[model samples]
Target chain A: MPSADEIFAGLMQGAREEAAELWEEAKEFSINTCWSLASQLVLVGQAFVAGEFTKAEVTKYLETIRLQFIATLAAALMKVEGLAERIVNAALTAVRDAINGALGFKLIV
Target chain B: MLRAIVVLLVVLVVSGCSSFQLGERYDKSLDDDLSAFQIEAVTFVASMRLNSGTPAGAFTSDAAKAFYPKASGTLSNIVVKAGLLSSRQCPINGIANSIGLPTIKIGGETIAADTPKTVVTGNCAVVTLLALQNVLADLEASHRDHQKIGPIRGQLAIDDINKAVATTLSGLRAKDL
Candidate 1:
């Protein structure tokens, strides 16, 4: 059987890869949201200036858009945190498995 | 002998791992509720799109009023269940607060950004459901204000709400083991 140190090194490498994946996901989400929000808000403003939407209508729509942005950001944060938690748990489980394997039994279960 | 050494190693590992409890565990019911809600919400928005610029889709019309009660009930159920599953304090809140918005300058005018009080919990379910409630509120408000849903706005609303729910569902489905 492989030594416990070797198993840990392998597991930590996996965790590092997961973390990098999460970072990429977070960046993509941020970029998309920023672009969408800015472009949508600009359109809303242009429509208002063109008299297509009333003052009250524009106000309501802006509020809706703001709330939507918040909601979207919150969802992204939850996803990032959820992925982080998974990485942590996976590392711990790997540690447990390594110990059990080293013992030639399920000692850590 | 060997048993004692193994026991010590196991104790060390467990103790080190236990304190890092990160987010709420997956709840099958919450997942089901969200999926059901997403379908209902998307269908409702699509219906609005189909009937855009018509009285049939007016907020004050009987057709629209009929959906309010059941939709609100399901949303409230989701919010309450998520709250029950969450810890009193969630780590997401802290992270959000730390990443608070920076002030922006527009046309040489300094506009102070609003504080980042967006996320209130580490529980993905709670974070998602509450945001969904706000989106629904916006939909209701817009419908009431505009009298009828427009095609473009209806499409946008569908996209916004769908994205919000879909991301969190992806998170909740994270592998448990």
Candidate 2:
């Protein structure tokens, strides 16, 4: 049978891997979002330079974009927060189980 | 070539204006909030360490305690970055609407319109503030009880935060500017 320490190590390793994977997904999402925003800015810029769009219009559009970006970011971060919480819970549980197994007592968390 | 030059100059000038600057301010504020959240998270983990006596200059193996704090930090960083990414959605849609551009399709997902911009932005701020408040509350509770946070309860709090944020983004679609 694997020692409690060994089990703990394995669990921690798994948690780390899971967390890393989620972070990567989040990063990719961020890059894609930036690209999309950049494209929009380019299009808007083109219109304004061509005398098709006025300064006031550009300002309004930019303000709207700014608000939208903040809202979107908040939502994405929340998902990451959920993942972190799960990882922490898993770590805590692993610790509790390891301690219980070693000490032979049901310690209340 | 002349058109391209004009377009480039326009992009610089427009993006450098007050409106774009205000957006940058909001982005900074959001980052500040996330940083505060991260500090609270780390403190919470430290409190857990104290209650459990598994590490933090205790008798428990140093390796185990070391693992948690590092894990917590990494998780915090990832969540903040992801949140920043999600914030980009609103701006993309807003720009599209302002210019009468087509809906932005990204990552196999079509960005559409759902809620009013003011309403959505207001809700986003509220949810973020609430999440921070929740973290503060949890820290206080942990200190008062003199115990590590229960895993189940911690998970629930996290779920609550996530739900609050998700609600803000739900039903979002491109609107006509």
Which has the greatest lDDT?
1
Q: For model 2, how does the per-residue alpha-carbon lDDT over B11-79 read when each residue is reduced to its tens digit? A: 433343211111111344444445554554555445454444334323234543453455346545534
What lDDT score is found at residue A23 in candidate 2? 58
Inter-residue clash pairs, candidate 1: none
- Model 1, CA-based lDDT: 0.62
TM-score of each: 0.67, 0.28
Q: Top DockQ: which candidate number?
A: 1
Question: What's every prediction's RMSD, in angstroms?
Answer: 11.6, 26.7
Separate DockQ for every predicted complex: 0.14, 0.03
The residue-by-residue lDDT of candidate 1 on B93-133, one tens digit each, is 55544554433222343444332334455355566555567
Identify the runs in model 2 with alpha carbons over 4 angstroms from their true place: A1-30, A42-55, A103-105, B1-177
Worst 10 residues of 2 chain B by lDDT: B17-26
Name the weakest run of 10 consecutive residues (lDDT summed) in model 1 chain B. Answer: B100-109
Task: Give residue B73's error in model 1 in angstroms.
Answer: 1.2
Please report how far candidate 2 places residue B63 from its true position, in Å.
64
